[model samples]
Each structure stands twice: as C-alpha cells, then as structure tokens.
Target: MSQTPNRSYADIRKALLAGEETALLDVREEAPFAEAHPLFAANIPLSKLELEVYARIPRRDTRVTVYDAGEGLAERAAHKLRDLGYVDVALLEGGLEGWRAAGGELFKDVNVPSKAFGELVESERHTPSLAAEEVKALLDAKADVVVLDARRFDEYQTMSIPTGVSVPGAELVLRVAEIAPNPATRVIVNCAGRTRSIIGTQSLVNAGIPNPVAALRNGTIGWTLAGQQLDHGQARRFSEVSEVTRRQAAEAARAVADKAGVGRASLAQLGAWQAETARTTYLFDVRTPEEYEAGHLPGARSVPGGQLVQETDHVASVRGARLVLADDDGVRANMSASWLAQMGWEVHVLDDVPASTFTQAGPWQAPLPALPATEEITPQTLADWLQEGDARVLDFTASANHVKRHIPGAWWALRGQLAEALARVPAASRYVLTCGSSLLARFAVAEVKATTGRDVYLLAGGTAAWVAAGLPVEEGEQHLASPRIDRYRRPYEGTDNPREAMQGYLDWEFGLVEQLGRDSTHGFFVI
Candidate 1:
C-alpha cells in the first residue's frame, strides 16, 4: 500500500478547508471506505494501487494520507508508494478510525452523486428556510405542506416524524407520481442529517418532477432540537445516531424498541427457524470474498452485508421469507438487522455463532483458496425442489475482478442492481449461491437473508472450493450481457462496468453523474 513519504491530518484538513488542491487519498477496502469517509477523500484501495498507481493518483507530489481500521495497513501502503516513487505520502495518524478518536467527522450514504443534488436544492430556495415556529404556525392554520423522509424504507423505519412516509432519495424520480400523486402534495426530503435530504429533494427539482419541494432544514437533528415529537417503529428509531453517534442514538433506539416493540426469539422459536428450509437457507459471511474464502460456514452465500442490503432484490425475489444473518463483527449484524427488520422477514443474528447448529468452516481466508471436497447436490434434488418451492442461482465467480471464470449455470447480478434484479424471486423458494471461492458464497448468504428473507445455502467451499472439494466452476459475471454499471467501488475491485450504474436505476442516476462530473473537487475514486 506504500505510495511515498508522508503528511499530517491537521495540514491536510487545513488544505481542504483552504480549498488547497491536496488529494485526500483513502487506502482501505471500498466497502469500509464507503461506510464512512472524509467529505473529499477519494478511495484508491491498497490492493489496486500497485497496478493503477499513477493513473489514480496522477500527481506524484500531491499530499496523500492512508489509513486502515487502525491496523497500520497505511504504513505498509506508504512503503508500497515509496517503492513506486511517489513522494509526499503519509499515513493518516489513525486513518478513519483515528479521525473518530480525534472527533473528525465520518459521512454515510453511498452515492456521492447525491451531494451534488443537495447543492441544487439549496440553490432553488436561495433564501434561508422558515423557522420551526413559522412552519408550525402554517401547520396550525392547515396550510399546504408535506414532509417526506428521503432515506430508504429501512432507514425510515428506525425513526421518522409522526406523519412522514418513506420516499427514498432515488424514488423522487421514479415514484414522483406516488409522492406528489395529486400534484398539490408538497414534498420535502429529510435524513438524519442534511446531505441526503437536500440532495433527494433537489433531484426532483432538477428532473422537473413538478411538485413544490423543499428540504427539512438541518434534517432530523433540527426537528428534535425544535422540541418536536418523533415517531418510532417496531424496529427502527428515528434519530441522528450512528457508530459515530451511538451514545446519542441510544435513547432513540430504546424508544424505537418501545414504540414498535421487538422481542428476541426464544430457544423454541430459534429451533423453529432451523426447521424451516422450504426456501434457500443462505448463511452469508458479509466480509470480502478473500475473507470469506479464508474460512466461513460450509454452506453460505458470499454477498458482503453492505453490498447485500444495498442490492437485495438482485439476490432473491421472495418478499415474505425466512433469512438468517451472521457476521464476525457484531456491528455489521446489528446495523444490518436494522435494515432487515424493515424489509420484513423472520430474521436472526446467530449471536452465539459457531455454538449454534451451524459452525464456521474454519479460520481466515487467503486471497483465494482452492475448492474443498464434497459431493454435489444431485440434479435430482435441485430439479425436485425447484418444482415444489422456489429457487434461483447466481454466481459471483466473476469476482468483480477481470471476469476470471464462472460456475456452469451461474447468473451475474451486479452488486448494485442485485436489489431491483432480485425483486422477481418467488417467496416460497430456496436457491444455492456460488462464487469462485466459498468466501463469497457465504457473503451471498447475508445478502439473501437481508433482502428477500428467504432460505439459501452455500457450496461447501466455493465453485473453486467445491471443485477443489470436487464441485464445479463455470466462467463469467452472468450468462447474458444486459449492460450494467459494474465499476468496482475501489481500485482493488479492478476495472470493468460503467462508471455510473445502469440507466433508469433508482431514477436519479443520470443527472447525478452529470453533475458529479461538473463538480471538480476531488474526482470519485470509485464512482
């Protein structure tokens, strides 16, 4: 991961504030970087840096700071840079993890395109927004006003205003008819904080969605500070809390638990879940494919939890199915479960992990492991079950690297489109998930569980693990090339798909990409 010598956080933060042309480089996995990052940090994963070193960080002399989850991964990355001849390379004193300790900010919401959209919203108003009291007065007088929560349904469930309905940011374009169905329904977008709502509301204005739209000034934080009452759902509590705001969100979480009311399943209930295998019973690892291959449950999918939830529909079609989730990091399970609760499923976290009926395959994965040994599920079993219940199969074997190879009958569902793609699955079915290695198969398990809440299983290792274990390996991302936005979120993900997602994806894509090009801050390392 080495790039060059070094720099300091204060120096870089100042340069950023002063609008200096410093390149804020984050050298972590795309998934982790996407979770939270600096406003201007462009991701250039440590893995791919060796190959695309110059093209990515064109300016050899630009100041660069690298960081990891505090494992000193950055130091190694720095060394890599020095060998490559890039000067002015320094590790983030603590990386993103360190920034938090120093009280530096961490941002959420994946689409950087949304940030541009927010600017458009701010410009539309041109003037400061009405005060809370002013809006309250209008409500008392029954003036026309509509508040829209712009986050995903999963996010909306956690916490929202009493009367607001879920209208995700991407929906402003596709579901405009639903939001302002009558033409007079005023729309206002809001999230826990400002950016998402600001961008979401503006996307409609930019797309000409034909409705009076505005943003909830300052988002949920503003509402609560105004002494207004917020609504809590069975599983979600509306507040501005995160790993970044855990202490603050605690009260809200409890209120949400109280309002919607959730209870842990008893041992009997847990046993019942183990018995329901009519559909695919997927056990996903939710880590990188490399991590998955290192060691995971014998049979599980390998969709990383973040990617799984983000691309739910593409993984499975079942709406009311059963899903079980697992993650080495409990935070992933906790954060992921919050979303699963909203999608509606019989969800379990398997807190005891290996102690339960399911056991982990073994220890950590190497970059890629050869297949293991196991007899195949007879075609008779697959064919017989295909009739009674439901099932669909996908092969992530392409690895998002350079289409290395694929499973014989695997289909390619790009991580981003997996959600909309999988919406077509039947609720009462099951499916076998495969990838080049067993690691990704387990991750696919997490995706299936989070999205469709259906049953699923993994090939003992992977297609490779299976073949090494004596299964099979096909070749490609999918059977058909229907044109997709397959660009890896990071350099290590390697190159392939379009910089932007597929057309008509979630409604707000095209315009956002266009604006992103226009805003010349630091270019997106992953787009």
Candidate 2:
C-alpha cells in the first residue's frame, strides 16, 4: 500500500501491446475489484495469496506487477510474493488512480475478459436475440414459448422475466429439448447481463436444438430499460433430465465441443495431467453448487459451468494451464469446455466417467494453510480477554457472516481498510483479530501492529472455533467499525436493486466491447 518505484501504467501498456507476457495483479477483494479495474488485471487478494498464488502464477520469476487503490495492501502482497520466491515482483505506479490519471480505462464487474469475449462471439457469429417488448407480447398472448433464465439460481430468484424458468447456460443444450419437447415451441434464453444470454442462446443453436431459440437481448437490464415488469422471488428450476434426454444432450454437446476443438479426456488422462508437477492442472466439476455439495468427484472443485465461463480468470488465473472439467451429466462439462477452449485455454471434458467416481460427498471447503509468526490465542483466552475488558476484538470476516454470529462485543472491520478504521477507534492496549477461519486475520496482524503499536493476536481458529468451544457470541450487525465496501453491490444479485441502477449496469456492459478494443491486452479468441 506504500508508494515505491515500480512500473507505471505506460510500462504495462507497452508490454501488453508488444505481446509480452506479464501478470498485472489487483491485490484487493472481489467486490472492489468488480467495482473497477483494468481489463486484464487478475485479482488475487492478499488474504488468499498463500492459498492461490502458487497454482495461479506458477513461475516465481515471471514478471508480475501488483496494484491497489492506495489502500496499502499491495506492498504487503508484493512482499509475500517475494517471500514465496518470486524474483520479479513490483508495484504498479500510482495504483488504480494512477492508471486512470494516465488515461487507462477501468471496467466494472468480474470476468470482464470473458464477457468481452462473449460480445465478440455475438459480433462474429451473429447470435440472435429478441427485444423485451417482443418477448413480453409472447408472454401476454400465452404463446407456446418456453423462457429459460441462463443464470445462477440465486440470481434468477432476484429478478427475471415473467414465466421464465431457471436453466443456466451450461444446462441449456442439455435441457432445452426436454423443456420444449414440441419442435414448434419457441425458446428464449436470458441472464442478468448480456454474456450468458448470448452464449446460452448460441449453445442451443450450436447443439442443434429442435426449437427456434433466441436470447432476451441485454438480459434483465434491457428488460428494465424497456419498462417491462420483472418477476421476483421466482423458484422454478429445470426438471431432472431423463436418461433419453441425457443421451441426446450429451451427443448434441459433444458435437459442438468437437467442432470447437475441445479435448476429451478419460480419468486416466486426467490423472496423467495431474502428475505433471511442472504444469498447473485445475480439475473442476461443472455442476450446480448444490449438486457438487451433495456429491462430487474427489479433488474436483465446484465451479458450475456457466459461472466458470463467465469467470474464467477468477477460477484459473494461469492462462495456459490445463483445465479438466467433470459433470455427472456430461453436457455441462462439454458445453463449458467448448467456450473455454476458444478462450485460449487447454481445456478438456472428462468423458465416460461414472457417478461411482464421485466417492466424496457433503460440503467441501479448501484447506487453510498455516500462518507462521503471528501468535494464535485460543477461544478460552479470548473469552478471558473479553471479560477483563483489556483487549479490543475486531472481526475481519464478511459482514453477512458477522451478522449471523460473531464473538460478543467484537467490532467488524474490512481487512483492506483496517488501518484507516483503527485511526478512528479508541486504541486498546491489545488488539485481537478474528474471522470465520482466522486465515484472513493472520494477514492483518502485521498491519494492525504497525499502525497501532500495540500487541496483536489472532483468534486460534476464528469464530467457528469460538462456537465450537461453546462460548457466548452476539448476533446481528453489532459493533461495526468499517463499512462493507469489500465487495460491490451487484445490480443482479439481490431482490431489491433499483431499476435505474440496473439500467446503468446494462449501459456499463454495453460499452465493454469498445473498452476491450481500447485496452487490447486481453488475449481472447472467439471460435
């Protein structure tokens, strides 16, 4: 977060324009990263540095530049990279503000590159779409048209067109025929924004679905802009696919995947890829998070196919890494692979694998790595500190989690703005930090200690440990010290976003293709 001699935005632009390999990183949380950032900047927040960096940016000596919006997080992140043996790490001169000052454009939302690529797909392939007015007329007339919302379940529940059922992009080809068995029935695919709708509609066309299909142009944004009513609290989801439907969907998806040059890998082939230590191999299960949580292949992380395509950089930061996707139904994996392959990743769909291969079940969370140097205080010790009133408790976990439950009397603070918030707080002799797992609190220890010149300690296992120890805790948004700016409030995320905000969001997405042209750093290719 401190200023130092590092590469300017111009330097980064020169390298990108020259086709040189570079990793321009934004060392911040996803929310702010989604609010505004460079088109090609990969976000690897400081809290997850140890957990994700090695796999994402594998080569230690690879040229890397880190930046933050003067938040003081970047310098520590750069140091962590060096400690991990990265020899060519530096800060971005002027951070986000500097980039703007130098006439570099900032884009909103996660996965801008993938979204831009989707726009490119539509530009080249001429994916067809219908205006909100036209779709509204069909719904009013009760035409035999099935509308599919190609977004995550929660997103669909937020706001959707009338009579639209949830059928995420990955499931479009797999479930379209089942939804519209009559060949004469019309089909409509839509999402919160443009990318998923366009890509989902195109997937149905590429898979050769029986029904005539089109996207709800510009998605919910366009619907709202056109003064069309949107349904909220919708719960309808796609029905279970029959064996016949599954077979048909697999054949349809596979043909498109083959045409897109996506590879088909066996479990043995995936094992071979995993054995290559020098290469980064990401194994993902492209199914709904609920399905993944119920049962999934061992070592395969849950990244639903639709979200994976929309957020490729978020899941796999290493551009050239080998990606192997798995899904019990096969269609989602294959369809997702087709898009990823064109995005310039060496992607494969695991084929002919039985459900028996998914021996692991229940909820899965990534294991937390140990944080050295910082002393950890047990829950019992923290209880005594609370009773004695000598230590100030600060919870660095998400506000949503804090609202559910946190240590009694602990003030919630954003990790990136801890220093700024500490200045306004009543200084304590001892400062103790806690989060859901305490992994993030460990990263904050040094910064808090430096800023306050007080003793700092991490809650051994975080709030979860405190609960496990049967300690009393408070519930609700109590004792808050910082605002929840860690993440941006997405217009398509909740049930209550204003129509104007939604329209503005659509306007932002509409201009991304032009922004992509200006940046010209993203190495995206559409098939």
Candidate 3:
C-alpha cells in the first residue's frame, strides 16, 4: 500500500511567496489552462515522468513539490517522487485552486490586445478630437488636414471617410509617415473604438510628427448620429460577420485538436520515465488552475502557458529535467512549446492524446466563462443600427478594449462596472456589448440579460473585426486605467492572483493595453 506523501500548502506557499528557490510542478491538461493558471509552475504529467524522471529531473536532492486538483493526486505524485529518490519532494495542499486563491499569479492569454491599445494611449496625449461635422466643416473651409484610420483594410471597407486611409493599430507607429505624408497634413486617426485612434494620433504627435494629429470627435458614431449618411455596402460604418459564416467556422473546429497535450512520448520513452528511479517527476499543466481543478489527468500539474513561458527556470529549475505540458487545449501547448523548445531543453507538447478518464467525467468546466446573451441576435441586424443612425450605441467593451470614443452620446464602461454603467444607461433603448472579438461580447450580452436583462446585442466580431471591414472610425483619446500610467499603480504589482483587483492590476502592470476582454466576471471574449 504505497500512499502519496503528505505536504502542507503553507510550506509551499512560504517558499514561493518568499521567493525561495523551489520546484513547483503542475500536472493539468491544456484547454483549461488556456483560460488561466499559476504564474510560476511547469507542466509534467505523472505518466510521462514515470519514464523520464532521472533523465529529466536528474536531481535527487532538490526541493520539488507536486500539485493537481486536490483529490489525492498531488500526494500520489509526491510518493512517486520519493520512490524515484527525489531527496525533497512535497505536495501542494489543496492543489491548484489553493495556490491561485492565495495570491499566486494566475495567467490568461498573452495579454495582447490590451497592450496594443496601451501602445496607442501612450503615444499621444489623449489625441483629443472634434466631431465629424467639425472635421467636414474644416475640410469645406479648406483646412489643411489629413485623416488616419488606425484600423484594418476590412474595417476601412466596412465604413471609412472617403479621404481616410487604413492603418492598423500596430502599423500606425511605423506607417504614420506614409499616411501623414507632409508635416502640414494635420493627421487625425480613428477606429470604431477610441484605442486605435488615440494610439495612432498619439504616436505621430508623440514622435513629433510635424503635422497636427487629433482624434476625430465621436468617431464614426458622431458622423452617423449627426444626421450624416453612412456609406453602406460600398463602405460600411463598421465590420459585421454573418452569423452563418461564424457558426460554420465554429462547427468546422469542433474538437479536432486535443487542446491540452502534445509531443507525447513513445511507449519506450514513457517506460524510461517510470523506471527512472533517480529523478523527480515534474508534471506541468499549462492550463489555468481552475481548469486543473474541474478534473485534469490523475496526476497532471498546472502552469497556464503564459506563466510557464515567462518563468520557466523558476518552476522547473532542473535545467534539463523532463517537462510534460498539458493545456486545456493545443493553443496553449503550441504557443508555450515554441518558447520552451528555444530554451535548449528537451521540451515536448503533449496534445491530441485523450485520457479515458476525462471523456468519462462528463463536461469539464471553463476557467473563465462569459455571460451569454439571453436572446440570439444577428450581425446584420446590428449593422443595420449603425447604418440607420436611428439609435446611439455604446461598445461597452470589457477591459479587452474598454469603451473608447463613441458617437456623441455613446459611452465606455468597465466589465466589472457594468451594473452601474447599465443602471445609468437608459432602459428603454437597446445597447451593444463589445470586446476584442465577439466571444466576450456575446458573454457581456449574457450578463446584461441575466442582470438588467435589457435589449442588448454583441458587436459582431467585436471592434477588431469592425476595423477589419474598413468602417468609418471616429478617432479620439480615451484613457485606460493602468498601474504603469503615471496616475495609477497596483498594490503589490503581480500577475498570479485570480482576485478581481489583481486581474485589473495585472492587466495594466503587465503592459496589457487590452487584457481580460472587457468583463471582469466570468465574462470574457475570445480574441
């Protein structure tokens, strides 16, 4: 009767929290990890470690700790570590959830959109702007001005000023020279939301682009709300993907990839791990802790790829030890494996492999679940609203892109602040929930439905897709709250805590211009 070792969570916490040198092993699958995870854990599956412990860990004297979703997994893993002669091995009490709830850095995706937006805000001083009427008036009066739409070509195609040229947010910094040719051009940048527009104009102004760069006031929203006609079909005001197309795409991707594990070892290699009596088994689940908890492999650890990539050495200190990766899905595995492979270790991404236990366990929970819309809505219908100008709509983007510039009366609100924002919003009018992509926006609509339960629809494809359509975007400066910003800072400045405050702090402190897809609750949008 070999039982797993008993370890105290407090001891593991003491070491990690105090920044002491210790090995933190995570054993969880992938897809769930994609949602969120510990900032300093590595992935190594028990089955994989059973074969490659000596070759991988190669150290019998290191202080190694194993964790999973409680349920006696970590203890079993610890005992195996001992049998393999790992001099000092312990189990994380309460497994993944305990570590995260105790202020550990839990990670989500790479914090991309938010950072992209931050780049925009930092480049210029709010790029304060004026309305379309004002800009048109200036043009009519022969004012010397050039307009820049910091959106994609598709966005431009959807709706854009005849004179405005498309320049995606990332491209603005390098391409501003092309769009705002002369210093006297008076450059103005706009996107459906304020981030891109602010970033674009600010980039030029900050870099001292000789011309005057300003955001269009109220962006396209102002243009339409001002009783102006939106160029439809030929030029839409924003992006709209047909529901049929999106659903088809989703259906096409129906469970082809394992989403969590990759680079599986052959039977021989697995057998080697099991026989490696002189090594420690470090199982790392790159998925988020919550995902690990809902039910992961019997002894899989959790790392949540982002953290694993950033803090590899810290988690798997054995420079050459075995690292088994499990993601909630392949996305995290693929993304993390690319980085780990470059670090000179024998790293394998184990995915497309199925565990019989997982299939039999029923539905696994999502680490971060978005609120769903009570009523189903179509993109064309939402597009109709933008073209008609019959109603003023707010993006109500989550932190992913938080509300930027809106038509004259449109507004922006934090996902956590939805209740208050909605309370302030008129109940009689319909509202639009938006995020980077429609994933979170759809959830936002769901939250609204569950709470205010008002007439709300998600922005088709979110604003990024909107910009892709070559839609008219009103440029303006909208400020985001970030610890890096001179005016704001986080308490401890961390990325591991699953706490709401920490999420917001990390969203800013970690250079995420657009992090956490607008909503703070379980609500989120997949980019």
Maximum-lDDT candidate: 2
TM-score of every candidate relative to the true structure: 0.35, 0.86, 0.31
- Which TM-score value belongs to model 1? 0.35
lDDT, candidate 3, residue 154?
Answer: 62
lDDT tens digits by residue: candidate 2, 163-256: 9999988988888877899999999999987999999999988889878899999888778778888899999999887899899899888888
lDDT of each: 0.50, 0.84, 0.50
RMSD of each: 24.0, 3.6, 19.5
**Per-residue lDDT tens digits of candidate 1, residues 1-527?**
44344455676666654544455666665666666776556665554454344534434555666776664557767886766666777777667766666656565334343343344435444523444455556566776676667665665776776567765543344344543556776666666545556545544554445567767765655555566656767242222223433332232332332222223433355457546534333344554454466666554556554444444432322223345555543434433443344333345554545534435455432232223233345334544454564556655534463255554545555433346546643344566666655444554565565777767666554555545544444556445322233333421111122323211222332244344443333222210
* Per-residue lDDT value at 444 in model 1: 50
Report the lDDT tens digits of candidate 3 across residue range 146-199. 666665556566677546665554334334554445767777777643444554
Best by TM-score: 2
Give candidate 3's whole-model lDDT.
0.50
Sorting all predicted structures by TM-score, with the top scorer first, yields 2, 1, 3
TM-score winner, 1 or 3: 1
Among all windows of 10 consecutive residues in model 3, the one with the lowest summed lDDT is 518-527
Q: How much is 19 displaced in model 2, in angstroms? A: 8.2
Candidate 3 residue runs with Cα over 4 Å from true position:
1-308, 311-322, 325-380, 386-410, 423-428, 468-470, 477-527
